[model samples]
Target chain A: MAFSAFASAPAAAEPAVRRRSWVALVLLLPGILYLLLFFITPLVSLVFTSFQQPVIGGDIGQYSAGFKWENYTESVTQYLPLILRAFGYAVLATVLALVISYPLAYFIGVKVRSFPLVQSLLLTLVIAPFFISFLLRTLAWKQIMSDEGPIVVALKALSVFPNDGHITGTPFAVVFGLTYNFIPFMTLPLYATLERLDVRYIEAGNDLYASPFTTFRKITVPLSLPGIVSGTLLTFIPAAGDYINASGDFLGSAQTSMVGNAIESNFLVTQNYPVAAALSIVLMAVILVIVGLYVRRAGTEDLV
Target chain B: MAAGTFAEKGADLELVGITKTFPGFTAIQSLDLFIPAGSFFALLGPSGCGKTTTLRLVAGLEEPTAGRIVIGGQDVTATKSFQRPVNTVFQSYALFPHMTVLENVAFGLRRRSIASPLEKAHEALRLVELDHLAARRPGQLSGGQQQRVALARAVVNRPALLLLDEPLGALDLKLRRQMQLELKDIQSEVGLTFLHVTHDQEEAMTMADTIAVMNKGEIEQMGAPEELYELPRTAFVANFLGQSNLFTGEVSGSTPDALTVAIAGQRLIIPTARAPRRKGTVTVGVRPEKLLLLTSAPAPSSGSNALGPGRVIDVSFSGVSTQYTVAIPGAGDVVVFAQNMVFGPVVHVGAEVWVSWNVEHGFGLEDSVEEAAAGVQDAAAAQSADADTRTGVTSSVRA
Candidate 1:
């Protein structure tokens, strides 16, 4: 029954091809409708809200329709330091994620390749954090960094921390949560690239008088650049705009409040629609610019 | 040159009592080989026959279970691949996909920090006629072009020994033949010792100065290509190197002229020098091209061996020659190849025919010692043995 529609009249071959395109267009209707209703509508509404002006003498949350572009300039000026701080935390988190993930990905992809079941078990462990709510995981980190927790107490015991100092509500805790939550995103892409790396290329390099370290530098590093580029984008884009880790309800204190926290407060606490909309738009634009510059610099066209 | 230094020219390679064993089985058993400087050598065998393992041992990719490898009088068995002065043209051409062809060729030079690596790399590229494509990546090139890039990459080093592991296995037949001549030319022009490993017999014969026929983790025979083909010492060589028709018979007697072998109530004389075994049961073989077909028996001649009155079972026409399979009742089907100087096959199927050959062309092998050399002959032997069993004479029964 499924193939019968495809097996239309042969004498009308041209018409059948035309009809086939119509059938393909019909199959696309639901996705197109969903994108238009959910995505395009919200995006246009957000852009409209970013340009809205506050009513000179109205109640809270009231605004007038106008091209009051000052909303962008004013909000960006007020939150410029927090915006830069968000970017700094995101960059640090992405670098930490990469440093931790590469070895784990390489271990799964190249080292345990002959033991596929063990490799798959390790891969499942990397992904197993997703099975629980990240919010709950963030709370768990909160507990782990509490005063009586082993990590804080051990650091105090080791003299790495001043005995009188504390651990919770620090920038380290917020960045740690971000890195922990986004590590699997960094790892899976790197694994996909490394698993398909032909060992023969490495052997050829070795045979051509390349020391193993030189071969890793010349061949392995360049080949995995595509993975690093994509993994960085995946981690950075989310980490920069992530409110969960930087919210006062989570890891952040007043000192570590990132742009995401400020935007959240502007919308819910202050009931300021234009500033919230403006902040979200600015976050997306800056991420796009950073990603564009990164992809161009990395010089790999095979991005996924 | 001493232990790690290389001579300016190709170096003689010596493998003394090389043995390699895996966990499950022995790959190569107690093998010794010597290749003179600058000779193109081939290790020819079927898959699982340890030819590739032998190549890996020499390349220092796989350590031998027990052996010593000496290249240019320097013991390289203990050295890593990068420390040894050896380069390889790998099977899939193993070119770096991320680098331009020029950069791929320059990789080894850069590793050693050689002066003017790119200049030298371009010169090597020009040698393989790939200089025009040097700026492009290997992925953009065709299989043939990538093959040339690999050749250039290996040849640029000018190592004392160059290892090629089935380098032409990926090309089509015409391109493989073209590359065979090109590879031979490069070897001679560079004057470097080449040790090529392959499963293709014709490829080995076409390119190598010396061919080592390996079977079952052992060297069956090693000699010049034509010498191995013409005077193969083992039945495995006779069957594996090319087509051979084998017959088992008792050594009846000898004349000053030749030794006589009696088969099915007929006596066939082979030269004394041609027969390896002078007494008891022996297996004699003649190449297919040396045999001719006749519709009727001629008056018996003293200088010939003829097995006859067989019926033609099949005939196939190749462009250069016509091949016929003649089935003798108590003897196996004998293959005959005749040149196409005339039209079609000289005889048709189901015709009575006599298969004849010059007596000097036949060679005898020891049947008792070569019981393991019965693989390719088993199919034809089983058929004839069945027929002999029906008649209760059993002329060729070794099992």
Candidate 2:
């Protein structure tokens, strides 16, 4: 609760400029009241639950409120592999999405700028896939890569797939699903930035005796850094916390379960609320630290 | 060695039979031009008159559909833009937003095997007097400073030819005047061939040694500023460069040196030696400053001023001159600008005056009156239409 409040405090400074105004306070009452009820109250209770102790000689789900910080340590020790695997899959998917989206965005933004008809048509095609349900799309991908699907059958006939090898319930399928689903998230921000790029800079580069490749490297790449940063962040954050694609009933099996699956099973099936809440808090903290380091190391602070 | 050859014979930039066609329009048509080495030349015209197209052709930014380009006695028509021995200062400045001022100036040098790139970049910045701001990005500088940086970047390469495409168009009026003088000074100090393209008549006249006035993808007239202004051969040239009072006339009599034209039943004499193509039907043009207004009748023996009575229809007093539009009995409205000396004779709107000018002051032109009027109307319509389309003016975005 304190962390979230610190993150959003800067954005609330405008209305607070009039420090003595009851009208400003009144205007913010509804939103503040809503956050207190739905967000802050539940968040405080979750933190309380994270410190609860399991009751001795009681039912399996019974517990008592106490100082049990050991719950956080035990959860981290047991689920450390799943936590690291989740981040690895997220990093791979985010990188793949960025590599695939940058060229597609550039082609739609700069190459077809003169032809408004073709440009809008291609942009619409990029976004049209979102009209279908996300679960349906992932399910369709599952069918396409299943053991009985044409891709697996064709590989088996060509002797590329061994008799015992399979693509279903593998890490490859999970990462592929994550990348395919989050491509639009990566593309939209990139398109918005590249669409406004000035072509005159490129011509100026050529006029200065720089070759076409050098011009793209020095001018185009640096100008588009903001798009690349935003797109990667957008794809990576949600992919790190996603559970459906890595669940046992979906693309992954028991061996490939991620941190999200572990938290889900602990919370719903086992009814161990303290351990689940501890894992959730740890996941949020770890993501925040990784993102902060990535942003600092990217060294695009001046460009943005 | 290449610089030695260029210095010996000048830049010697040449364009032979150049033509450029878009989807349905031909921007340039068989244009032929030769820019002498180490000369400050300008291509001056109104909007869409192919002046910019000609500059881009020379810069190798656009390949001409038909002609060949030769620079320093070498054929460069087939070469790419980066391979040409030339550089351009873009109208937008187009400074690399991510690079500092020093890096922007050193961009061209770093691409090739140049020695002491950092020293050379600082020297170029010193020429533009912006060396102290070398560590700052282009966005941190003012518009005038950015313009100077662009100039420094282009000149640092020291190519055979330097092309400036409206390099001062984005500055304020006062800054533009200052940069115009600075650009001219830079060109002379460097002694490289400078080809400037602009639509501003005053800028072109003040900076260029030779000016080519282009119209509709063709050169209408090319000469020194005084020559083009004094002895314009066509109605378009006379009206475009400066204001001219033109009257349609017919050649009633002729001499070996002059011709007497009958204009509105009044006889006017124009020198035949000075006129280029004088058909029987000709248009007589006179500069507004050349016509002298005399409220009183001239002496009977005076032969220098050919006199006619007219009524003043309009009067405007500027700081240095008083311009009057007089409606004459035979000729249409004749505009006369008199120097504001001693503030004598405050002419009212309805005052009667005698409009007189020397016979040599009038020149015959080739365009008919109908053609001139239609051309002016078309130009006015085009200007307003252009303004409507460019209504959304935006400030430059910088990081």
Candidate 3:
């Protein structure tokens, strides 16, 4: 039956198209098996765990496999503030990353293109942070904003910061860390699209009575939509669940704890396996929903 | 936005002492030109002749190093491109890939705060016979379709002047021919000043009301197509515009009606009216089609010049005409294009023949033999790989 269904397609297509072939199936088999083993299998177990219940009078970290629909509601009620804060921080970081990366990408990809050496050097600077570990970078930022740090001490002397005020444990620090870590993700994709942009389209926009700013709004932004969409996805999805920047050991403190930190503490220290799994599932679902709405609203399928 | 006095109707364009110098070389020398409103003018030349630069200066995309640009009796030298009454159909047909055909065409009207942009866009699309494809994206259209869409997008604004920068260079030969004629029809219908830049000689001849032959950042000659082709005053114009059988020599004698020049002791007559004004040495030539070849010496014909007894070195038979390369005793090879009329005997290679043409068909140039020889070399180099090289340079300029 499958063969019959597939037979009509290849027969109609010209040979040049090569629409169906066993070589393709063979090529895809490794990827499919790899995803099933490494990614999908763990995901299935996580879903099952999200629906499990704790054992009555049992040891810590032990659970009974059963339907527990109340687990979702219980986790949402207990850590509601953390979940909301996680999403809010992610949105702020994504917007900041977009604004900062666009100009940098434009400068490197289009403006300095005539000087190849300068372009390469600027691109290297953007990617240089990746050589260091993510946790190390967050820790470094924490030290730079500490009370005794050079920047904070200078700000205090200038009366820019309060004498007794602290920079760590603030929402601003966590968001700043998120934006900094994800900026390369935004810049590289934006550069990929902007580098290949045909200048004539922009010139045509100017020729059609669009001012320079208007041309940027109508022509350059629309042409770079693909990059913007991918960059935002890269930033928002990971940032929403990030624990390092919000953990007490890094840029943030207990007041700034996100959904990730809550899940980590429950899973390891508190040994509340069901609540941790439920919280994890909630975060995933929330990200998926927001991303779906965003992609649909952007309408980049036609723009690119 | 100092476009307060902008004229919606077609407007004349004038360039006074315009010059543009790039990093290594001057693209346009100090020059002055005036183009009347509502006329279809063409700038024709080989690659890198600065025609595109001149078009950019007039479009206000490039500022002249030293000159004033006037349009419709207004000095617009400092006006920005967006405020100028000009639009360009780029060589690559640079349509916005994100927008649909109708949206792309309506873009300008919307920018200018004009009402009912969609209706006007549809009307322009119908003018180009592309209304049926209005909803399709530019990326989905074929080259010819995209070309028409680009044209429609520019014409929808009804700018006083429209610049076409080798707009059909990307199409196939047959499609380019079709678009040439279609563009001519659109030009007449719109009654706007259409400044077309092209490297294709046949296209300029087929579409342009007037053609300017440009060489090395300067206008060599400008006139009606037939006039320029028949009586080119410069060696560069004669060779660049079309194939010429140039013979360079010192003037042997002169009469009230004609001047005779000696090449390898063989004399050829050029009408005094067609001779270049400055007198010492002269280069005279005829178009290939104007030359006739006879297997034997003709009985002395009136009002004609004859060069004799040459051996046919090569014969290439095209459908409508056959080209023969004849090697004269003292002169270099001269090319003659003979019509392939039915019942005419075929002339094979190695045949002895006499090459001849009417005296009125001969035109003289003051440029010497060295200049004509240099022109022949430049023309040979330009004919091959000219199209891709030019388009590549244009696309890379922004970088």
Q: Which candidate is the best by TM-score?
A: 3
lDDT of candidate model 3 versus the reference: 0.88
For candidate 3, write residues A1-304 as lDDT tens digits.
4354557675656774855788989999999999999999989898889889889998988998998989999999999999999999999999999999999999998998789999999999999999999989999999999989988899999998889988888999999999999999999999999998888888899899999999999999999999999999999999999999999999899899999999999999998888899999999999999999999998998874
Candidate 2: tens digits of C-alpha lDDT, residues B1-399? 232122332388998999999889999989888999999998987789898989888888898999899998899999988888788999999999889999999998887657778899999999989999999999999999999999999988887799999999878789999889988898888888999998777889899999888888988778888888888766667766777887777788887888877876667788887665466777777899998888887654323445467889998988799999999877888889989875754688999888778877888776676766654554455455545544633222211
Ranked by lDDT from best down, the candidates are: 3, 1, 2
Task: Find the candidate with the highest DockQ and give its number.
Answer: 3
lDDT of each: 0.87, 0.85, 0.88
**Chain A, model 2: TM:** 0.86
Clashes of each: 0, 1, 0
Model 1 chain B scores worst on lDDT over the 10 consecutive residues at: B390-399
Quality of candidate 2 docking, DockQ:
0.37
TM-score, cand. 2 vs. native: 0.88
| Predicted candidate 1 versus true structure: per-residue lDDT over A149-249, tens digit per residue | 88889998998988777666789888998999999999999999899888888889999888889988888878888888888889999999988888777
Evaluated at residue B41, the lDDT of candidate 2 is 92
